[model samples]
Target: MEHLQPSLTIDFAQLSEAGRKDENQDTVGARFPEGPALATKGVAIAIADGVSSSSAARQASQTAVTAILTDYYATPDTWRTGQSASRVIHSINRYLWSQSQNNVRQEGYLTTLSLLVLKGDKLFTFHVGDSRIYRLRAGQLEQLTRDHNQRIDKNTTYLSRALGADLSLEIDMESLETERGDIYLLSTDGLHDFIDHRTLTEKLQSSSDLEALTHQLHQLALANGSQDNISVQIARVDDIGTPSESDAITVLSRLPFAPLLKTGQTLDGLTVEKILHESERSQVYLVKTVDGTPLVMKTPSVNYEDDAAYIERFVRESWIGSRLANRHVVRVVEPPQTRTCLYYLTEYIAGPTLTQVINERAPLPVSDAVELAEQLVMGIRALHRKDTLHQDLKPDNVVVGAQGICLVDFGSCWVAGIEEMASPIAADKILGTLNYSAPEYRYGGPTGQRSDQFSLAVLMYEMLTGKHPFGEAYGKAMSLPQFQKIKYRSALQFNPLVPVWMDRALEKALSIQPGQRYEVLSEWLQDLKRPNPNWLTNRHKPIMERHPEKVWKGLAFAGWAVAAGLLVFIATR
Candidate 1:
């Protein structure tokens, strides 16, 4: 019941001054969150220096610093640090650029920004313009950012890259290993230009107090006659915290795996009503709390008790499921009592799996199939929005009930944020069902949202026609050549009710190459809902190709009539 403690900790301090300038155009800020956020998002420190020539330089600098500190935390915890920071920075750039363009005087809003995030055992840096980030460790000082200014002369230089400088912005990003005693310094050109790296490194090494060090750096820059606004920020890593994998294992291994349960068996105050499902990796039991509320309890199989990677994944499945809240996704819930073993609970759904529905109702009505597809897409989009991919999207993983289609089973889910962390265990490259997996998984090609799209398309094909788009050969095809030899069969071949546009959409989504698939899931869903303008030509195809079964049936009837007439004529003669 204890919260995940903050594993990453740091000593941080910052200062900004106008120096000789009339107004301070430099801004600095930092956020050291407590508890899970600190462990997930880490500590954020940022410094921004406004362009002296711009009319709104002060506002630009303040906005840049404030936005990074605030918006970075607002991003999904499942997003990689670079992904979250880049998206926030890009949005800030757009806002500043649009504001400048709307001004009557055509004045610009521009600033140089440097952000340093201490996450886990790593440091991530994002930089633009002349602002710099330096790391001091073991008496060695290294500049981690390159100035974006172009030198025109000895004393004159122009910034080639800065926030709001143009419609598009290019920023530098880098990641490096961090040690407990590592000291990082972020400063604007006002400070770095006046003070040399040797002086900065010496000061950082000599000082133990980061607060006093920041002020010392600022005053030193001012004494050096910095003509512009000066700002300085420092962070000394107190702890890189436990490595992610180790922390994960420690938390996941706290309790032994729950023993197999049967009806009327109780553990952690939840009594098992029945065995719901069992597999090589886990067991799912329908359980009830003392209040009689039904829930699904998933426990790892004893076979995997010694498997560190499997145990980590099993724990993370519960972690991931608890975070995702969507009508079409099964909800993982906290147990009424503190868990005494390695198992998680979810709200029980009284419905059959999609596999059962398909088996009982093959060739479902077109409208019914489309409706399920729409709900499935919603659930898949929810996962994608969190930077998580439902790599194993299949009928067996989906449950259809009165509430709608709910996606279950996250053992194969891939999270971008988690993937960024270093792990001692190698992840399984192929986790999804091969029959429903995208071709990229087999070919060692890149996979992303599009990969999920391919899996969803296969599910859709099965729902509508009770068949795979590429037939049974698809599940067995492992090589590019084998896949290339397989052709997509029309859904209408089995289900005459499928519209041509819908079939075309399925074909595109099921493309052997990931690039050929829909760029987004919504586009494919739109095509499935209505006739695509581009596919209107499909309706004009010859009847033989469009309705081959009907054509063959008609030919058979005509031949039978002719044969009957010839027989009667020969008998009469």
Candidate 2:
């Protein structure tokens, strides 16, 4: 069947046969979920090759192929393809392993599994054992998976990893962008070992039909004297659709923004209660539906009416908020049934921004600061787990509610999967605040989860000390040297209540170089609660090393004292 959409189209086919074998022990299958599932889950294809040594090996192949096709669709639609497919593969491996244990000879039901999942414009690959998945594009064949086999000699080898081989499975996974006219080929060893690259390239160049290509591959394998069952699957991509942000920009460009909202004014079924915030990029308003449910409406700023990048980011903010459903992250509300203008709604959080809390309540208690920092880390962890980075994490972007802290702005968030797709936005521009931004950002270095950790550490230090680690020195810095010159004062200088170990933790997170910073958010979070013995033992730093200014003043004071004592002795003599 053909999977067709306005922007994306794909066709797939498969052929399998027992070659020089009494029974066919290989299984191959493909599935494309329809409707919403099609959009969310997309398509999946699986191939499994059963071992010849076992009696019920065919059962392992059939079970793995069938389970992946059926259970992958049963997974939560919101899940990313890699996560969903891996979960299903794990379950299938366990079931096959258990069946082997119940057998009389304990000769396991062994099989090799390779799976490919196409979602949006990206392909997710999962592999275990010797089966292979390959991509043929532009007359070149690229093997996307590694073989799990141990070679004893040049002529002999054995499968090192396979389904039913062990209770625990390590499946290799990778994701890549799919281009138009890309052809993906999957096969067992029977076909790949027999078909040479030249012949495969010739066949692919000659045929346009996926079904015929698969059939030709199987026939070639048989003609080349393959002893095992031959199986092959082919998928051809015709087109890829515009991503959500691009689509949103197209839809919103035709619609104009509603006039500035005032208290008691109504727009898009939401009654304006108050103006929440306003900036050059966007405006936020406290609004309520007719049912009295509170909501926060965010509208694009009139200043960015002609700016495509700004508008895309504004729309992407809502898209990101909708995908993440954590208590610490702000939730995006569905659009009203009827809308009069371009704006998005979010659950109205009743609390002050962390900036407000820090301003009015400067130098918060150590426990209180730790508590808020912990909550913010939870939100950062949520983003990181999804392969996303909140490039702009600061006190202003967080809300301090009674329930706890919630991270608010996603305009500067970077999602890994989405970033791989083509977009009008460019990466040269830096997207973060000055002082809290990691030093690498100022120098145009790549940012990742560690970059967010640096920003989080800046926030934690600011909460305790009421000052930025680098202060105003980081503002408008041009070069890496300038960033390296900025001094990071110990948090204890401002708040003695902050333990020495806590300051050291902040010190590492506040490293000028991204590489020197804490690699993971959890490491810094753990350090805040309990002191690391290594940190404690190494805390004895010289005054010049710890506080340069203090060291100079102490030296000047000693000089003045020595001069005054000598002058008194001279006068007495």
Give each model's clash number.
0, 0
Q: What is the C-alpha RMSD of each candidate to the true structure, in Å?
A: 7.0, 5.9
lDDT of 1 by residue, 54-83 (tens): 989999999999999999999988888999
Cα displacement (Å) at residue 563, model 1:
35
> For candidate 1, what's the RMSD?
7.0
lDDT of all predictions: 0.88, 0.83
Evaluated with TM-score, which candidate comes out highest? 1
lDDT of model 1 at residue 331? 95
